[model samples]
Target: MSFQAYLDNIQAKTGKSPSDFKALAEKMGFTLNGKIKPDVKATQITDWLKAEFDLGHGHAMAVYALLKGKKPD
Candidate 1:
């Protein structure tokens, strides 16, 4: 899946748009355009997804990939 595909998948699976998640992440200091730093980890993203949207590992991975400009293959 492409980055856009991942984002679309996330929305489809969780009923939440990527922009919605982006807002939530920003509130938590996970800026999408911020410098690449080690402060944020995949686990944090996973936890956030699970806690906020009831997303499982697969869905969370899709969200993470979209956030990081990656696309699942």
Candidate 2:
């Protein structure tokens, strides 16, 4: 799937936009100022996504890509 497709599916499943996830990540200290923190590991974010949103590894990685400033192509 395309990057946007992954994000769209995630939103459809979780009722949250990427922006919402970013905000929540910030609150969780996984991110700051809309960016993933330097000290944060991808697994930490992926694990949280899995636990909280029931997202699969690929879907969780999609969110991680977004946090890393990846744009859909």
Candidate 3:
């Protein structure tokens, strides 16, 4: 599937867009100023998304990609 397809499925399943995840991440101190915090590991973020959003590894990684400044395809 395409990258956007993964994002779409995630949104459909979680009822949250990428922007929403960013906001949530900030609230949880996983991110700051619209970027992933220097002290936060990718695994930490992926674990959070997996546990909280019921996302699989790949889907969680997509969110990580976004947090790392990857523009959506």
**1-73, model 2: which lDDT tens digit per residue?**
8999999999999999989988999999998888888999999999999999999999999999998999866
lDDT tens digits, residue span 1-73, model 3:
8888888999999999989988999999998899888989999999999999999999999999887888778
Which regions of candidate 2 fall more than 4 Å away from where they truly are? none
The root-mean-square deviation over C-alpha atoms between each candidate and the true structure, in angstroms, is 3.1, 0.9, 0.8
lDDT of 1 by residue, 20-51 (tens): 77667777787646322368898888898888
Single out the weakest 10-residue window by summed lDDT for candidate 3. Answer: 64-73
Backbone Cα, N, C clashes tallied per candidate: 0, 0, 0
lDDT of each: 0.72, 0.94, 0.92
Model 2 scores worst on lDDT over the 10 consecutive residues at: 64-73
Q: Which candidate should be chosen as best, given lDDT against the real structure?
A: 2
Which residue runs of candidate 3 sit more than 4 Å off their true CA positions? none
Better of 1 and 2 by lDDT: 2
Sorted on lDDT, best first, the list reads 2, 3, 1
**Could you tell me how far off, in angstroms, the CA of residue 20 lies in candidate 1 after the best superposition?**
1.6
